[model samples]
Target: MNHWNSGTAAALLSAILMGGSAAVFTTMPAYAQETVKLELWSRQDPSGPLRAGNVVKAAERLNKELEAEGSPKRVEVAVRESPAKGFDDDALQLLKVFGIDQGPDMFIAAHEWVCAFQEDGFLLKLDDYIAKYPQHFGTIFPSLWSSAKCPDGTYAIPQDAEARMFFYNKKLLREAGYDDAFVDALPERALSGDLTMDELIDIAKQVVDKTKAKYGILHRPNKGPDYIMAFNAYGNDFVDPASGNLLLERDKLAAAFGWFERAVKEGVIPANNTAMEFDALRKEFYTGNAAFWMYGIWDLGSVAFPTYGLPKDEKGFFADWGWIAGPAAAKGGSPVSLTHPIVYAISASTKEPELAVRLLGHASAADLNTDHAVTTTHIGIKPEQLEDPRYAEAWPLAKATELLKITKFLPNNAQFGELNGIIYAAIQGIESGRLSADDAAEFVIDEASASLEDVVVK
Candidate 1:
């Protein structure tokens, strides 16, 4: 937080070389402390409540640092919570606020939407600040910073990341006559691409046929990142590397949609999946009425362990429950694990950009970020967090970290949020029996081409 410029050094040298009197020190005027209030915008999400709270805690930490540095400025963080149900909605609502010049000093947002904000001139580029504060950001995992970057520079600071996978009930698999070893090897099979997407459905079909479970496979009943992992596994990245434009390949799109089509046709995934309540889906999977629940890692701390009374310790948890990355589309193909990172960004219109940056730096401290990680079952941002005993105790985090080897991120395109909406709608269409896999692919193309700009179809 302290910067030593040339002027300070010049005054110090003059005082020392000229044998200046003590009056040089005594004549300096007192600093009346100035309180800088920084407002932060965040959604009212229960899963990662500390996303906003940590910034508040950072304000207190920054005040102490200011006191120690004998500086005249102290920071106060005021939180503005939005009532959006998900990050996509929150980002849209925030854009409207920014358009009106009412955006806060800083905001917590989904990483994929950071570029969208940057395009609108709503962000403060952070490359210089990140370079200035090595004590804070130097230890952050080098890979995670990519999520916060735009073409020009980094625009946000990654807060936390979690792995997405299909969580399965081992008890249900065993009830379907699979032995312990077969169930335990699922994660490894997924990573090695020995398991194919169709094979996962076949296993789920067995659970539905031989067991009393009503659902074989279940996913989030809304538009979100979990389902996108399936699309990614089927070789649809939805963006072009060469042109930096939205990319849509017809065959890949159908192949991904085909997986869902097969699931619904086989009665593995319910036809009304998109219509089901969120908590009901969790109850079905956690209470052993479903075989697989496609979701993220944080569900353990937020819902699975706490609400459903699942085993908390590693061995106990694995004894009845397990997870696997989205399996390959074909043998020898790569599996997929999608990581949706939440980030903290400062507004371009903020009055105190430097103080805001330093405050977020303290918020990203190893201990504070670990507090959020361990409490929510999220992976830590900094490498030093691996040594934290409390973090090591969070067994789910350590286990999920293995998936980072093949983890992928949603593209950081400005139009991706809107394009994701179209993709989700096509999913709903397929699950509800209104569209075949091929039809869903057409629907996505027509929607994206009509609405989004600069789309590249292959």
Candidate 2:
């Protein structure tokens, strides 16, 4: 038989024997009579083909284990992969169009979407499901429980968590005469939550002066979601949940923006930040042209050391890099970093919501989820998962964990995207010398409040 025909026949056989959807049969054997099929959806990564492969393997392994144990219900998993085109805005629009029934059974989504989806009645309330199934819910972290919880107290289960930090070149530091002692002291200082915006700028200048690198910090000043990290670090809460009033914390923002403007004016930062794509900025860091890069831990596995089309032991790419938690607003202030928790939520219209919940639980088991966490270097929701040897095996986990403890989530309100855009434009203006720091701060507050006035925060 031809490959296509044989594959089709296998799918049909399994579906017939299990009496479930064709999607279920494709991922499992026919002998599992009570198999449940789950359709998962995620945005495809252009650079990382292994993401889909890993999810498949995770499901396949769970199926085999269930079969061996003679479990009554088997999991049949299928993924509907789509390109990650327009960030969360596009994803939200797509979810709205798909509604509850036609959407995937369970899919990965940003934490911010949970509140909006719950309010729209598009998501199933997992609290009862979690309460009944202790094994699955117990695996998640405590902070996630709160972050994923909606104002109405219904929400999705967190799948993975991520936090940002400063990526520095250790070798470059050494070249600049910063010995191991100085490098080792960074984390403690960062953890103390005292590093102010001005201190960060001074340190960047020191690194540039000492290393003679092209620039001290390679920062992308576009109005993307990434800038939320910087804004949060400065104590600016962009969205007020209670009133849905966009609050820019103008004083704090002005200080932070002034710091950036001064850095560019002093030549410590690249003047081309306004035009730099994330990829281009990363390339500059990877190639050793920049001393510091602020990015999430997710990039460590893929970009830090490109495995393909490069020497096996590519040294300079990330050799000089060491990580430090993002600097805080003031000495002794709470060190804040941004996190966008990725979660698994069931469609309210799913034919088998219970079955979807089970599959999601299986996927989140410490053993299975750890692999993805290690691969992506994401902070897992489960505390025990943090202790997994796999996490210890990866350096990014240690750094991410420390930062995750102090991290804060962006407001989950639907208008978050619009609020972010206003903030971004203001930051761009400040960086480009089009607006003074004080003016930029006022602009962000005035514009964001006007744009998001209709979004009821409660």
Candidate 3:
């Protein structure tokens, strides 16, 4: 899409040479003013519209700075919307867009895909920019910066993140004969690794047997990040640290798949879980027909509280609903949680990389980010965002932040999406009774080795 105003774009090149003091430019003519149109490619995700919208809003903030600095230029953001179904598909489409040299000035993407873009020379290296703009990025949590980095250096800005956990219905636990204290202690127990994966399934089993819940536990029906926490808990990181290659340990894969196998065999998870509609799965969990839903923090604002009339207040919500980290694979082992960050990256070919960086810097401002976080139930990238009253009011963000201490990210490897697809298929095979857990693990190993380059199998 042509995102620039007519004739204004032609003036952009000359304005760089025509730089003058504010007194000089302001006195000359309004016609002398230049507009730098920074086109942004963004997926039309209703859950996080502000992912792109905030960048557009930041143009106002950036233009004001430009004026104060006595520049003749003003920045305008043009958003090119993508109709992809999810981030994976959107990422693939973006790769082709960049391949043809039709990429936008900037784009929002899954953090995992930053390296993929970097590999193809499509991304601007942001290390220098990030260091120079201390005011913009100085207060962001140090931990999150890792998500925006590649093997060489930083390549993108972390936009937002959310915690993934097992959201359990406290009411169902109580109905299953658990006391309030017992139910409340579950999250702490999980954090300390006093709770194990088998214990979680057993608790779900109890809820199924003693309560009217039709399903004891449920997860997303499609390929996504939530279920990766289970694999992480079972010790499948999917990457070799020393070589940076995709790693698949057959036994570790089997252990994680075995959890799913046992859940289905014990009737905790439905046999056709992988085939169910997304809405139907959410309905079962939100409507109290399921005891536990494996999902993320955003579901509260995006689905549970708004769509299902869940308690909005902290105390009210905790009384009947709560969440726990993915329990440790064994007692005394580390628990796991996943935070899949969405990030912003500048195109390598953008005419105005500095302006694009500044624009995203303003977008990453604590207050502006808090607006996105509180409204969409996502965790903020900056520690300063915690000071915002609106952020404090969104208790789920604060509560979920506790899990970040132990959270893991999907590996930033370029081939991870393909590997995850294979792992997902193995899960489907196990759950559908087409393969045993051991067979599922073998399936993942064979499929990944064949489809992906440099896969390390053990």
Candidate 4:
């Protein structure tokens, strides 16, 4: 794979510029002279293309460019898939792999894990490389840089961003007697605070009561990131960004848990909500049986349209579904969107760190990233990609990106996961009718306090 032919530019340049024959280049040793295979680990994403897939594609491009430029080093990217059971599970597998010195040459991970991985010596510092290869990463969006940062150093390059929002079935809403104008104004009303969470639940209940849809509103079937938006909307500051300490108020936690508890009691959400699997929950909305679904933009391609086989430029999807940011819990309060980004990191154990970083930059370039964004339902991480014609074709990308203003991201902190799990358990208990909201809140605080000691304040 590393053999450069006589037809390469090196032969031409040697003949023209150096006044030598093609034989003059035969003795120049090729870059590491064998096909450099790099292992890349990606958490499986059935909803869309794994962000690591983008880097693999880019590495393929880099290989061709290298061969064209008469460089003997050809990159071969080997993908290692870890079960996408959950972020904690996937992160655990990665951490364990690194412990055994069997980690990949590169990896795609959530930015929230940045702090923990750096502290454990599992991540490579990229500041030096970023300075050495400015051209590859120079054009990255400044805002995305936050996803790659940690106190230790910048650990990775931003690969893709996903916005979690409220999705309603337009067809069901129409069947429930909403007019076309009303359907169009629903999301705007949500943004203006006219459509609060109470009203959202009421609307869903009405849809289910009046229409054939079996369900009304659906949230993540399992404990995942969607509920954090609800917590934030109810005025819970889960992290103290200044010191990266996990923090939450008992009153706010109770209010948020109570809202969801009411949702199940009102029959908009099922009591068995926590028992359903990811695929079944997604189908509840995509199959149009439920009035609303709270999920991320990543589903726009991998699951939503592909499951239905809808064509691009068709009005069916737009006519049948409308998306809104998560509604506020009360009147006069604003809705919130949650942004989670996947990042590409080179392994400290990699045989060739420079190649991995270069491949990441190639994958994040405007042309390559635009394709991934349009097809995978991810927002463009580069400024130039928004103007690309291919990216413009995916209508949701524009609207989703516009809604980035109200986004709340989980901070990069080690304790954030423990706090998140504590809250999710409370949600499950309260929503399942196993515990009252007050009891659930107490449980959350007690558990969180125990996990972090005095650091769990306010």
Best by TM-score: 3
Task: Report the C-alpha displacement of residue 302, candidate 3, in angstroms.
Answer: 3.0
> What would the TM-scores of all predictions be?
0.83, 0.79, 0.86, 0.75
Q: Model 3, range 197-240, lDDT digits (tens) per residue?
A: 99999999999999999999999999988999999999998878
lDDT of 3 at 82: 71
Tens-place lDDT digits, model 2, residues 1-458 = 11235555555334322422222224676677786777776655543333334445556766776777777777767766554453484366445445423456766677777777776667788888998888878757666665677666757887778877777777676777777877657767777876665676677777788766777777665655555666677776655556433455668778777777787877777767867877788877766667777777777777665632322242433344566777777788766666777777787877788767766766677876677777666777777776777776665665476666777777776677777777677767766779888898778667765665653221
Report lDDT per candidate: 0.87, 0.67, 0.87, 0.75
- Which scores better on TM-score, 2 or 3? 3
Clashes of each: 0, 6, 0, 0
What is the Å distance of residue 289 in model 1 from its true position? Answer: 3.3
Model 1 residue pairs with clashes: none
**Model 4 agreement with the true structure over 244-363: per-residue lDDT tens digits:** 566768898889888888888888988887788889988877887899888887677777776865444536667777799888889889888888887888777788887777777787
Predicted structure 3, TM vs. truth: 0.86
> C-alpha displacement of 2 in model 4, angstroms?
39
Better of 3 and 4 by lDDT: 3
Model 1 TM-score relative to the real fold: 0.83
lDDT of 1 by residue, 284-332 (tens): 9999899999999888988988899999999899888999999999999
